[model samples]
Target: MARDYNFWVYIVTNEHESVLYVGMTNDLARRISEHRAGEIPGFTADYRCTKLIYYEHCTDVQDAIAREKQLKKWSRSKKVALIASLNPRWKDLAPEILGE
Candidate 1:
């Protein structure tokens, strides 16, 4: 039997850390790369929201999507608090994703 992979719900922030973007994907690394490369277009690309600050793993895509939507509905302060809970300094987690 093939191993099942996880889906991810992630939050990315702009350079100035003024904006937050929530998204869900099965391949977090590739999705982050696309965001970094400006391939996503619209809000993410335009806002330069390439810093991966927070992420949660889910076995189901629906769960990941639901989490993403829930996070999106949260206030900015709430989102920031959530990120801070996991990453106190809000460091860029892109390298962590790549095992750097």
Candidate 2:
């Protein structure tokens, strides 16, 4: 039997919630951890985007990537509205994902 895999389109923000980032990954938990640990370097690290605010699951990688691209193209206020729709308080969803 073939195993199942899930792809994700996610949003994360800095502690101040001033910087928002959009990304796609196969492993949400690991990816968020990388952002938090600053292990990947670059924008997430530079912006200190450690809070996993919103995420959507997709069964197809193409769909996830497309969603990520769409979100990336959205205006900042639009993105903020999207995030608020799912995460009103902009809570850190990392610990939940990490199973803490």
**Candidate 1 C-alpha RMSD relative to the actual structure:** 1.4
Q: What does candidate 1's lDDT look like per residue over 19-71, in tens digits?
A: 99999999999999999899998999999999999999998777887899999
Question: What tens digits encode model 2's per-residue C-alpha lDDT throughout 1-100?
Answer: 9777799999999989888899999999999989989998899999999999999999888888899999999999999998889889888889999999
After superposing candidate 2, which stretches have Cα over 4 Å from the reference?
Answer: 1-3
**Per-residue error at 9 for model 1, in Å?**
0.4
Model 1 ranges with Cα > 4 A deviation: 1-3
Candidate 2 lDDT score at position 27 = 93
TM-score between model 1 and native = 0.93
Name the candidate that leads on lDDT.
Answer: 1
TM-score of each: 0.93, 0.94
